[model samples]
Target: MLYLICSVCLFSQSTGGIGIRATESRGAVISPVTAAEPKPELSSDRAILSPRDEYSSGGNAKADRGTVGHILHFSDVHLNISTSRNDSESAAIPTVYGKDAPITLLVSALAYAKKVLPKPDMFLFTGDSVVRGNMTEEYLAEVVEKNVKTMAKYYATSDSNKMKDVTTVVGNADTNPGYRMNLTDPTTEENPQIALIAGTWQDSLSKADLDLFKRRGYLAYALDDTLTVLTLNTLPYSPSHEPNTSDVLDPFGQFAWLNASLAALQSAGQSCFIVGHIPPVISSFGGSPMWNETYIRTYKKIVGQYSGIIKAQLFGHVHSIEFRLPLSCSLGAQFQRAGVLGDDAIEDKADLVPLFMTGAISPIFSSNPAFMVWDYDVTTHDLLDFTVHGGNISSTSGTVDWQPLFKASQEYGVSTLKASEIVNFVKRAETDAKLLEEYYFNSKAQSRLQSDCQDATCQAEWLCSLYWFSTVRDYDACVAFTTASKSNTTTSTTSTIQ
Candidate 1:
């Protein structure tokens, strides 16, 4: 039954878009405007601001006085070293649709990021260093080392040539067999896979962090006196993960450690960003859960307990731009697992942490390669805004042109990337045709690879995904309600016209 439902959902996503017309031609670049240039009016609902207007606002004047910090985030490079070596001649350009990224593409992306934000406060790479495939353990280690060194080299400080502070999580593909990790007692013995990856990251991590990561494939890096980044090894929680031990309740003792760490952070009055490879939510691409229900429930409970100190949850693996709000299921609604609920079941917004899924640098999913530069309040550790820069891979010319795709603040018209603001945007998109269409276009980083969605079921899936529905029954209810509402709206409009 689950397999059948997943098959149908996958089909819907593959054919889904918001039926928004493409304004720019394939590979067309929009020039950045200067401060002197007159700002364009928001005449059309589909219209978005130029890169200059989007970012040049400089946020709050007080923040401009140097209280703002920037973090450069990259994810899922998925470098295919085999293809890169075999096709050295064409390695200067980005890889085409079906293949993972080549060495050239990775270098190009890092170089572009360096050029744009040379001195970001911190660097974040949330997983998958190598492409997914069968390979010898030695060869996999070599690939991982190369990917790590490449990033370190690019972000090295100009003054001392030291590698910048980089926080990374272990993706499923980082191991020999994807989504498989050995469950060993960290104190008594070390996991060979985690040890190998830790060796490559030695330069970027502290001695304590390296030791901890070597043992269990997770670490907490203190970014500042008030801010820390907790990078998790989420493989054991994944549904696709291969079971290696009988202790399913707490794989590698990650949850207990997580709860303790968060509690410590809370006691110290410091905030943190929870970074992980696979998120603990329903996969928006397919109507399936990313982690097992047990892990998800445990994770949610821990996060909710420490919600006051968790700034945001950042994840990769989705390979697309999207976010998940706190699950707002009421007490009775949570237990009632079989059917859709009435409108009152939708609870009011709460101050739960918001999860931001970063897009991939690999175009393997037919998504344009992209990365993000995040702005935040230095004192409060609040996420202010983020700008996504995308590289358009041209099929005919076989080259990638990098440009700023959109800034979250300007595109969504939100003051900050808060959960409440994002929730409001989701509500607005439900009825605003132009806003919904614009969001659908940006969701894929403006790639034309997937066709526009014309089906109502597909459209509902896209919108409800933002809410992070934990159960299929809840997700289905949201979809059914949305589809019917749209139908009624259309009918009412038509009758008025007559």
Candidate 2:
């Protein structure tokens, strides 16, 4: 198990500081200037605060500014095309919010991303490349190929000489077309072998990653000396994606592999970012139970063990900009509840794992289609901020226009993205009429930024719907937290509402 302890700590009403020190780097920083108004020519590009200004602690007066790398993160681009089986003009998922775009609209969104956003050092896709969950093997192959080719086209170099390498993981839809519960079963009946699809993933992933995926459906890659990327194949863990038979081979042993990979990075003094399609949510915002109890327990254990080293956990498939907040209990408490680790083994370590839910590029069920740009300091692996680019998809109009939404720093009023900050933002928003109103209006895609919330009760439910708190007790705790916060505005009790 992973453990870290800081003998000294400072606890605040709104936030708590675990005595983790920030590492300093002497990199020369050139402050980036921002225009007073967004560039009209490229509305999709928003001026954001540079890391030097955003993360400056009241330290040295004249130290050089820091430089950091950026990541282009997007997922669930459910590309729909006419097929022999289905002649659907657009791919729309069944949901109160899901309303997706066809191929042309998707192309326009990608074009805008290419022209407006900063050239990223790395590109990440959390999966779901195809629109239809069920399709023939031939159709599935074609869809994956097209999805990879299209992304390659947009992120390619200006000279068109080199294509930026992409890091990706398998979504439920990517394994076999349509919804087949027999993914774990090969001997029972006729089933599309996942190996066939896994073979096709090589074009999108690195050579080493391709090998790892072929061997065990998961892989890890180091972005630089500072960041290690871990990709988990969560398809098997999802019952909706892979149901029954229990024959799916765990050749590489996902749990053991993850532990080993994370241990290696920790030993090397490197932080990490984990990418996956299905997040470990016991119950979804839609009130549907997703993961099996066993899987949830194991997943939480891994997260608990390495919570300190992981910089961020990025996932998609929920099709919204959601976040998983930190839990209040120490690892020991969590394990004691599970009856895994005893009270004697309890280490009162603070876990700060933040799971960022990236919205879908496909607007299928949702009114807005979106993508994210994660901005963080490379030296410290601190996630400073991120920007969401979303577009309005109209059935009548043939074209789609994309623009930037608010920045995390500007909206949340916090330079660092932490669980406490997010919790406080929700707590305050529940009581403050303006903040509550804005929360609902902005939760929608940039294209659908209108107030749908009728009252505070509705707004509170809408906000709570974004996270999977695991147990009924946890959910009730959040409701109580929000309710209590309304009465005592000055109380600074630490929240465990995940």
lDDT (CA) per prediction: 0.67, 0.56
Reference-based TM-score of each model: 0.81, 0.73
Candidate that would win on TM-score = 1
Query: Considering summed lDDT, which 10 consecutive residues are worst modelled in model 2?
Result: 26-35
Alpha-carbon RMSD to native, per candidate:
11.6, 9.0
Report how far residue 99 has shifted in candidate 2, in Å.
Answer: 4.7
Candidate 1, residues 40-148, lDDT tens digits: the string is: 3322122222212223333323324236677788999887776334546436644787678888888888887777776677788999988878888776777788787
Compose the digit string of candidate 2's lDDT tens values, residues 374-493: 877777776756777776654565345577766665565544665656655655554455665555555555546344665444544554544434444444444444444444554335
Q: Pick the candidate with the highest lDDT.
A: 1
lDDT of 2: 0.56
Off by over 4 Å in 1: 1-66, 83-94, 156-164, 244-247, 327-350, 491-498
